[model samples]
Target: MSSDPWETLRAATRARVGLGRAGDGLTTAENLRLAAAHAQARDAVHAPLDVDAVVGALGERAGPVVVSQVADRTEYLQRPDLGRRLASDHGLEAGTWDLALVVADGLSATAVHEHAAAMVDVLLPRLEGWAVAPVVVARQARVALGDEIAEALGARMVLVLIGERPGMSAPDSLGAYLTFDARPGRVDSERNCVSNIRPPDGLTYDAAAEVLVSLMTEAFRLQLTGVRLKDTGAALPSAAG
Candidate 1:
């Protein structure tokens, strides 16, 4: 019953558009939906990481899990610097590897809680020949934390599968960051990111895996990530079909 042409755009994206109003404000349904979304975003920020569940989801191919220097959720949001380092040598396992995969509870733990394992499932089979290290499940972590952990594990590259900052429409959106020659001092420009992984919308799991593996292959070949490397190449053999 809406006359606005923008209503057509609403079907394609989660973004709010051409919402019919009630009096001077949103309709009751819209108001309720907005409130619910706000609540979900708030809860996602404070949600705790289920470490055991995550490791179990990773199944037999898991590795030594670890926590970051960020002591708790409170500190993680307040002091991002702490989240970028390790507290002690707890899960820093010894091994030289081509890649280190870390799953971190970023701003929205809900994302990692839901998508990390599935994303891994998609990417792992494609990386059969690479010397991948144990999957590290880091709690209260930031993207840079993978750098320190990778350095400790003696890995040439690090991929951090993390929870992205939640938007009202996508509270459980997941993200990833890849760094070549990972080390403690690596800057943000040294990493490449792939974001918005979920189901029924956003980036599909299989597609995300394809993009990630492509970037990884390129990074290894060129010894760089971030701005220098782009993900426009043809898919790898495993990614095909």
Candidate 2:
């Protein structure tokens, strides 16, 4: 078993809030104080976001789903090639699935923590024809990593819900990038991204769920996604690109 990034992250949050430490159960006043301090400390980082913690937090649901732990970002950074896929030993899903939701700790863990599961929560129920498997990653992952995930799970489409680098205003925002027939050597524009996924900024989780369903439906009907498929209401995915 791997470490719980959310637990680790929550401890950081509590420490910032003066909650003492993990499992300490701080009082309301302590929480408020910590929140203030956390905010200040976060602001000090010019918008701090912890990608591992965030992605881990988002996958907090109880189910057949399995979440990965914080990977080594050091190797990912020093060897960009290493970040493109999970290890063969990682043992992601082995069988076929209609869709594999690959969660990554991109540049902002907080965003993954806040929005990944919530977004998937709203999306999965609406996808009638889709068989979903959860593949979570740690370290500063990237978009292309989904190709390996698709290959591992034998999935036709790969949707990666990862954290965007935190900005000054939106620190805990998540994003989804969907690619059809996702495998190796696919171009970047070959995918479609539904970004700005936090509340009050972009589409709500429920609404975005519908949009994703619609997009996938169209992709299924037309046998395409990414730049080759046409959205239900919009121009070709190329235009959206």
The candidate scoring highest on lDDT is 1
Segments in model 1 whose C-alpha atoms lie over 4 Å from true places = 1-7, 233-241
**After superposition on all CA atoms, what RMSD does each candidate show versus the true structure?**
3.1, 12.9
Clash pairs, candidate 2, are 17-34, 50-109, 51-108, 51-109, 54-109, 54-112, 54-113
Q: List per-prediction Cα lDDT, in the order shown.
A: 0.88, 0.65
- Residue-level error in angstroms, candidate 2, position 36: 12
Candidate 1 lDDT, 148-173, residue by residue in tens: 98889999999999999999999999
Q: Model 1, residue 88: what's the lDDT?
A: 89
Give the alpha carbon lDDT tens digit for every residue of 75-148 in model 2.
54466566675554665656778887776766666666667777877777787666776555544467778887
